[model samples]
Target chain A: MSFQISSQPIDLAVLRNALAHPHAGACATFEGWVRNHNDGRPVLSLEYEAYAGLAEKEGARILAEACAKFDLVAALAVHRTGHLQLGDLAVWVGVTAAHRDGAFGACRYIIDEAKARLPVWKKEHYADGVSAWLNCAIRGGFSTAAGPPSGPPTG
Target chain B: MKTVRIQYFALLREQRGVGQETLATAAATAGELYAELRSRHGFTLPADRLRVAINGEFAPWDASLTDGVELVFIPPVAGG
Candidate 1:
């Protein structure tokens, strides 16, 4: 699959193999991790959710765009859903191309676009036993902040 | 008249108190359906804050609502 979401832990090797090609001279990959903090608060964990069927369709479209825009042999991306602990892998994007430039550019392009466009939601649980769903009001300001959620506000 | 299968997520789900519901609506377009639901359910978010999808594909607000179609009101996605 070009792009997908998984509740089970991601297998990096599997995605890597999917991008493997004999002509590929360089590979670039991006991993988004569930960190322990956000906006100066200590985070306990995250609960990720998706409007599943649409998410898959949108995700595949993103990969298709990367293919059309960049000279790449293959590209794939997958996101995680459900409860996740600190430092858990939240998403992965892997791209393979004849050169490092295309691979790197496509990798960044996929992650950034996926973060902005996919129909996925994250609920953050704070260390103080507080929890809030992210993104409902995250467009709190008009800054072009590329994210793994740069200004995600919970609640 | 159309019967739409609506699915809610995140804050919308919490506000609606149910993940999915089937509704028979007189509204003709996706936007109209959302307006009716917003008023009836007191959904705090507006059509501008959410994206509408039908049958697993993103659709414009003015798109026609078909019977038994799966409708998803996607509140701002937070996927990384």
Candidate 2:
């Protein structure tokens, strides 16, 4: 798989090493971290879920698109699923290219496309002893038993 | 009628209390099939909120269905 959804904490070094190549003069990476706050609430943690079949396919497509659009030599992305604590890495992206501009643009393109297209959801656990699915209610999407999601996707 | 595998994810799975199911349907298109599942499962999310995938490829909701295809109804994604 060109992309992965893991239940373990991501190691940046491994992702970096995968892009190692003599032809790659530049590489760019992005890391999404879980923060402690959201829309006036203190977040304790988060639970992430995915439609695996589609997520894998779509993620691979995003990587391929970035490679083609930016003339990249390689690209990789990994997202974490399941409970994540504050400050934990939620997603990681890496792009390698012969030039700096291609690496930068492809890195941004992959992350943005993945955010818009992957079949993943996030549930926010708040300090108020409440947890709700974040942004799942937008545009008539899923309605939580707790009612509407208090915050749109911050990630 | 055609037989297909239906997979639910995110909010739909929680509402339906199921992640996957196999069913025989007389519905000719993905939209019709989704409408049926929505009624049967009482899915809270409406059709406009989802994207349909058949046999692992994203397709229009009106796309025709075939027997033994795998269908997934995607909820709004919040991935980073």
On lDDT, the leading prediction is 1
Regions of candidate 2 where Cα sits further than 4 Å from its true position: A138-155
Candidate 1, residue A136: Cα displacement in angstroms equals 1.1
lDDT of 1 by residue, A1-155 (tens): 46888889999887887878899999999988888888899999999998777788889999989988888888888899999998889999999889999999999999888888988999999999989877465343332333346655321
- What proportion of true contacts does candidate 2 retain? 0.78
Model 1 chain A — which ten-residue stretch has the worst lDDT? A138-147
In order, candidate lDDTs are 0.85, 0.84
* Model 1, runs deviating above 4 Å: A138-149, A152-155
What's the DockQ of model 2?
0.57
Over B1-80, each residue of candidate 2 has an lDDT whose tens digit, in order, gives: 89999888878888889899999999999999999998988877778777989998789999999899999998777787
- What are the clashing pairs of model 2? none
